[model samples]
Target: MTPAAPETIAPGVLRLTAPNPGPMTGPGTNSYVVGTGPCVIVDPGVDDDTHLEALVAAAPGAIEAVLVTHAHPDHTGGARRLAARLGVPVRGCDLALAQPYDPDHRVDAPLADGDVLDLGAVTLETVHTPGHAADHLCFFAREARLLLAGDTVMADVTVVILPPDGSMSDYLASIARLQAMPIDAIAPGHGRRLDEPAATLAHIVAHREQREAQVRDALAAGPTTARAIAARLYPDLDPRLTGMAATQVEAHLIRLAENGEAARDGESWRAGN
Candidate 1:
């Protein structure tokens, strides 16, 4: 498939998608340049040299700051290289988020919640929305009511909430925070730009709740490991997708355990209430 070329989706907002594409990353990671004159690049995508060169060429003006949504490779692989090329510091909620796949690639600054970054023509307000990753961040365009959603929300796919670093509670609360915003459009980390922010957010919220219910029903058959639960929930599951389904089940169970409705004993899980 042809990779996404740099295109201006909104006033001063240009999207450049990387070459990496898969079940998880959709049509590769979307790198965005948000503003004119001195602009801010969000999520520099994978570390392929060609992609980096294309990003630099497509940018409308001097790159003032490089912002990362999270530290995941597909989303941040090119950060350090791009930052060095542009002679600008990488910015994100966690400095670590700016580090590319290479350990030597690192962020120059930390962006705290509520911090406002000026991109010359447009202004981006940092919103710390941890869930997809503990250090995930979303940028809100103050005047335009636009959200640079990153992987916190996707166009067609639901984000995976893995354990340890990923939390269902944080993800849900983060979604709630976005739901409270007066958003005009969401430039997601993958797929197409989303309109009808309120409805889309609602659907995402409901989708998780539905997953929780499915997990609960599957548990009605008794205590089981996440893999067994996945088999029960998705009888026709493709072998390739088993890991994804299992991780999602584990995430839901983690939340259920927190709410005192489930318990984990070794590798098995059972309903507590």
Candidate 2:
């Protein structure tokens, strides 16, 4: 598939794919410019000079607000610099989201659930979807019913849930909530846009559930670490991605423990009581 590019996707939505494509960031981070006259930028990809110029040039006219979907550096690193150049306030679920990864990312406003940013022609309603990242937010466009699903839902691959901070149970619930919404299509953080949001969301939920079952079976053998279970379930997975696979296994283990389906013994997990 083609990487993200600078193009008008909908009536008032613009997509610009940064050049930082890799395993973590599928086709790099997808930066979206929403609205016509005064636009709201969501997840300005990287902090590179080239990407910043493309974003500013591809934008409509004046940048009213700069919005970050989550705290990941690839998504929010350019937000502060772009905001500074445009002289607009940076908005996000929390200012602290950008602090740890990017100290220079200055957040001017915090977006709460149900908060709406009206840009005359188009309006963006914030939906707090925290699973991939605790502070992840998806913006719903009222007119096109397009969901600017950050890393919460990827356009190509399934959303990767990082454990400890990212919860499998919470991610499942968040996706369920999104399925209930009036989403026509998903403009994800990576890859191309996804259609039939309902089907896609359902598949994601079911896919996670299947993986949870596989982890349970892996645990049935004996007490094991998350990495061990990941190896058992995905033995052929790429070496570099084994860590991510382990994290996902750990997330399922945590959810299973919470549901009394699995028991934890320090770093090792066994079948629940």
Candidate 3:
């Protein structure tokens, strides 16, 4: 399902949908525009001509900088093309691929806990919410108490924990960090906007805990593989989804092993004290 063109979410922010659809669910990626004068574009979505045109049409002449949440192809694919068209610097924690970004581009801007981007009318505070990826970030609007959550917190599905790049421990820590923030609304990377922001965070936290418990139980029953643990945990889930769930389970197992709750013996895994 191709999503509609760019739509305004607030007075100064517009959400644009990319044309590329993923393998599972979610029809398109989301790109966001913030502020009017000296505007900032976040997560330019997939590299598609239509999505780029839509973003250009929506922002017009005021585009100042492009900000990416992470280095994933879905999110950062259009950054170079869009930045080139706008003749503006593309800024993100990760370096822009292929072409060298403009000297004005702030790649190492040091996005610590309370760093804020004052984009004329609106101010976006950066929260280093890693785990979806090492360089992931979430922007927050203090006035509206709204969180522009990247893949760190999606509405419909769980983000992949592609290890070395992603970590289950960091993901849980990031969720706890966001839960502590005074947020009222959540504009996720995918699916519909979340109304009950706090409740949503709570649900995600609880769900992860439940999955961890299931993994623990499966290990206790007998020496099990990650695939076996995932099968037991998600018994009624689709066959295709099991592969993704297994990746998640493996991440959990790695975390558990690190914490001394589980151990690996060559190909097999077992519960530990």
> Against the true structure, what is each candidate's TM-score?
0.93, 0.94, 0.89
Scored against the true structure, residue 7 in model 2 reaches a CA lDDT of 81
In order, candidate lDDTs are 0.85, 0.85, 0.78
The total number of steric clashes, by the backbone 3 Å criterion, in model 2 comes to 0
lDDT, candidate 2, 43-119, per-residue tens: 88787778787777777767888899888888988888888888889898873442255556656898998999886
- In Å, residue 243's CA in model 2 sits off its true spot by 1.3
Ranking by lDDT: 2, 1, 3
Where does candidate 1 have its weakest 10-residue lDDT segment?
95-104
List residue ranges in candidate 2 displaced over 4 A.
Answer: 1-5, 95-100, 103-106
Candidate 1 residue lDDT tens string, 1-273: 334578887787889889988988898789988888788888989878888877777777888888888878788788888888888899886544332334544558988999997877788899999888788899898777889999999998889887767889899999999998889999999989998899899999999999899888877779899999888777897689999789888989999889998998999998887
Which pairs clash in model 2? none
Please write out the lDDT profile of model 3 over residues 1-273, one tens digit for every residue: 343577777667788877766654286677898876767888888667777777777873488878877777777788877888878776766533332223333353445557788777788898888776777789897767778898887876877776666788999999999988899888888767788988899898888888888888889898989988878777898777888888789888888988999999886799987
Better of 1 and 3 by TM-score: 1
Question: Candidate 2 — what's its lDDT?
Answer: 0.85
Candidate 3 RMSD computed on C-alpha atoms after optimal superposition onto the true structure: 4.0
